[model samples]
Target: MPSGSLRGQVALVTGAGRGIGREIAIGLAAEGMGVGLVGRTHETLTDTLKECARHGSRGVAVTADVTRHGSVREAVRAVERDLGPVDLLVNNAGQVDRAEVPLWETDPNHWWQVIETNLRGPYNLLRCVLPGMVERGRGRVVNLNSGFALRPDGNYTAYATSKGALLQLSDNIADSLAGHHVVVLDISPGAVATDMTAGMPMFQDMKTWGSIPYMVAVTVDAARGRFDALHGRFIHAGRDNLEELVRRAEEIREADARTLRLRPYGPQDPMG
Candidate 1:
């Protein structure tokens, strides 16, 4: 049965061809939302679209890359034309560092490519999608972020740096959308066993993996306003009880927890 509240609404999910993005698209569809599946591969996107249709949901697949602003704008237009104004935007398309190599040891082209795909991609989507949301006085954005953003890891410099920037971008956008009634969430799917993760050197030796269903559930809840209180806050799907977090949203927000920040060495330090 389709869940209530989301029926008839629309969602545009990037990287919907596979992995978490694929699952998220289907999850929203099951909840009765029209979905736009955006990805570089038409065949894979069409596969996801068909799955969404099985749930009796409307969907469209666009074979487009996220790194190009004009391409993203056109993609958004096509999705809106098919599924109505986007009520939710999921920036799920991203890549990780190719190998466990230090910054200088990494290939420069690959490093910049990662930067473009991870950081620039989300920025492009937001630029194209936010105006309508702001005008409508309602909408939500979910940026697939990571704990990597909160800490440093020399090996995955590009990936970590991009996510950290994205984290701040979400925080700033969330604050800007206060009066507009739009909320942005920075969430980490948390080591899900996707191809992206499979290629990651860190997850290769791990036996345990994050739950795709749990991650999907969190996304649906976010769309339905369950986690609106945690807007601009980082939500890790594999850890932290969501119910408990929601219950203490005010405390978390006031404490300014779960965001990237520079720690000062002393009270007199400017960063503090």
Candidate 2:
């Protein structure tokens, strides 16, 4: 049965053709949300849309490359026309390097492609959608982040760099939009087995994988504004205990934890 506080809300999920984005779209639909599936592949998005309808919610697929400004505007318009103003925007589309090569050894073209897709894509979507959200005085944005953002990795430079910037983007926008009731959050799906990751040599022999349901649960929580207090913060679906995180929300806020920031040398530092 479709059940949740987000029942009648509208959501737009980029990269919804497959993998984590696909699952998130269906999960939201199962919770009775009208969903707009955004992706580059029409066939795959159509299939996801069918699954969403089966869950008893309205679903529409808009094929568009997120990296393009025109495409993003079109997708946002289509979603709003069909599903109403997007109450939730999931910036799930992403790209990683073709191989695990060091930054100095990476292909320049492929590296830039990853940057454009992973970073510029979300910027485009936000530009297209944020105006309407601000006008409405309420909205939520969930950026699909990764542990690679914080942890230093030898390879996947573009992916990591883009995500780290994305985290900052969420944090900055979260603060800017706070009074407007538009919360932005960053979530790390945490090494989930997906089509994008399936081909990675790193996970070839891995046994345990992150839970997709748990990731979806966190997404839904963001959608319902359950974690608004933690806006602009990072949440790791596969690692931290969410209930405990909720209980420690105040401590987190007070300590300015779960966000990217610089550390001072001491309490008497210049800035301090």
Candidate 3:
């Protein structure tokens, strides 16, 4: 593919104020896609907007809360008014409990708040953006996910649960949009050294971490539909060899790999 294949395209990335979201927005703009920086902080979003402008791609900043439907709708409208209808949507805004504790011991309000931010945040964006994508018969969605979605985290119930639900959400949407040319993918950046990770007690002494470049590359690929064959599947940026995964795309579909699904017992089992 050409370097500027995404020229003139528009991408709206949530949580674009800082961390991985900020980096991804700049990277996308560097690839020739106009970017919409959506976040709660005007100053930080403006900072990212300026960086995108340095890349020679148009950038617009919109302040909005992802968990609110009306706010998301307005943000989408603002992006469209300035950039264009979003061709790529990155659902990267998320939150984790400030303190890790068992579900029962955790504050109920905080637990649900995390859930609302992680899951409902994406839901709100999807509802606002997908209608136009579907109408145009094309779009791409990259849902930032985590390993905890596949494995339970004893002390991180809300985060884990929301991510797990997000995986299912991606799969379900993929099914609904199969022939429409709109693709949805789940990407796990795997412990990037971000503000969120730095604040986590479990990662306080961690040394090794995933590369942000790899994560951005995966997002870029998804935006260009390079992984359409693996739509609705999870991409583990830190571990999965993307080239090999692409080569074995057929095999993955045949074996039903990289997606969330019920584990089948032996063939003799009734459910199997």
Candidate 4:
């Protein structure tokens, strides 16, 4: 909650080469977190390193493909060697293929690509990072899920389905790690302007939603654990009711914790 609360913390942001991931990496650095920028492109990763340096935080640019476990593992090791152990992990790498193709008409290769990047990538990072975090007993994980995760539309079968699965993954992680002081959450940026959408037809249609800066700010808050109250919940960007959304999430968590119902009596239950 205070400025620089993340000072001395090490944060790794995947896909930090550009777009929303770039902004999130820069934002974390600005908050005094040493940042590891992970992406497949060396050029874009270099840019992110410059941005983090400009913001006055130590940064390491690592070029790695998230879909490959070996690549991600090596990248994580490099970051740990350069910036110390990671205190935070942002699973932001994602891809959307065949955006115009319906589910039935989608190319199998394109569909698998989307799933690999969007879903498997996060799983790899979590698997690589969770052991260290659980050993330390303190860490934070933020998954950049999309608004489409909750509300899907036409022609986004691969992207939307992957994001929806990501949300569920975050939820499971939250439930499992709550006692470890490791918070896991899914954030929906709500149509921020990014290179991924810049030339798309939907870009013009969604330009009025919000810019990347606002989403970055919310993400920074999430990193500092300000939104711990909303773990296992979703938060939308550009909404006028963030406070209300957070309150609702807290209420939901509390309700779930308080209400425990028994399952229907099964054959295995002798008491039934």
* RMSD to native, candidate 4: 4.5
Query: Candidates sorted by lDDT, descending order?
Result: 1, 3, 2, 4
**Cα lDDT of model 2 by residue, 1-272, tens digit:** 44756788999999999999999999899888999999999999999999999988998999999999999999999999988999999999999888998889999999999999999999999999999999999999999999998877777888889999899888788778988889888899899999888877778897999989878888987888788888889998889888898888889989989999887889999865
Give candidate 2 regions above 4 Å deviation. Answer: 265-272
Scanning candidate 2 in windows of ten residues, the lowest lDDT window is: 1-10
Clashing pairs in 1: none
Instruction: List, residue by residue over 1-272, the lDDT tens digit for candidate 1.
Output: 45646998999999999999999999999999999999999999999999999999999999888999989999999999988999999999999889999998999999999999999999999999999999999999999999898889999999999999999988877788978999999989888899988898788798988899889988999999998998888988788888899999999999998777778899999879
- Name model 1 segments beyond 4 Å from true: 1-4
Each candidate structure's TM-score, on Cα atoms with residue i matched to residue i, is 0.97, 0.96, 0.96, 0.89
Clashes of 1: 0
lDDT of 4 by residue, 1-272 (tens): 32776899999999999998998898888889999999999999999899889878999999999999999999999999999999989998888764676788889998999999999999999999988998899888888888777666678888888988888777667778988888887877777677777655666666375768888888788877778877777666665377776667667787653122344488798554
For model 4, the superposed segments whose C-alpha errors exceed 4 Å read 256-272
Per-residue error (Å), model 1, residue 236: 0.9
- Taking the tens digit of each residue's C-alpha lDDT, what string does model 3 give over 1-272? 32776899999999999999999998899899999899999999999999999888998999999999999999999999999999999999999977878877999998999999999999999999999999999999999999999998988999999999999899888888878889898999999999999988999989998899889888998888889889888988888889998899889988888888777687787766
Q: Give Cα distance to truth, residue 243, candidate 2, Å.
A: 1.0
How big is the positional error of residue 229 in model 1, measured in Å on the Cα after superposition? 1.0
Which parts of model 3 have CA positions greater than 4 angstroms off?
A: none
After TM-score superposition, what is the CA distance of residue 161 in candidate 2 from its true location, in Å? 0.6
**Each candidate structure's count of clashing pairs:** 0, 0, 0, 0
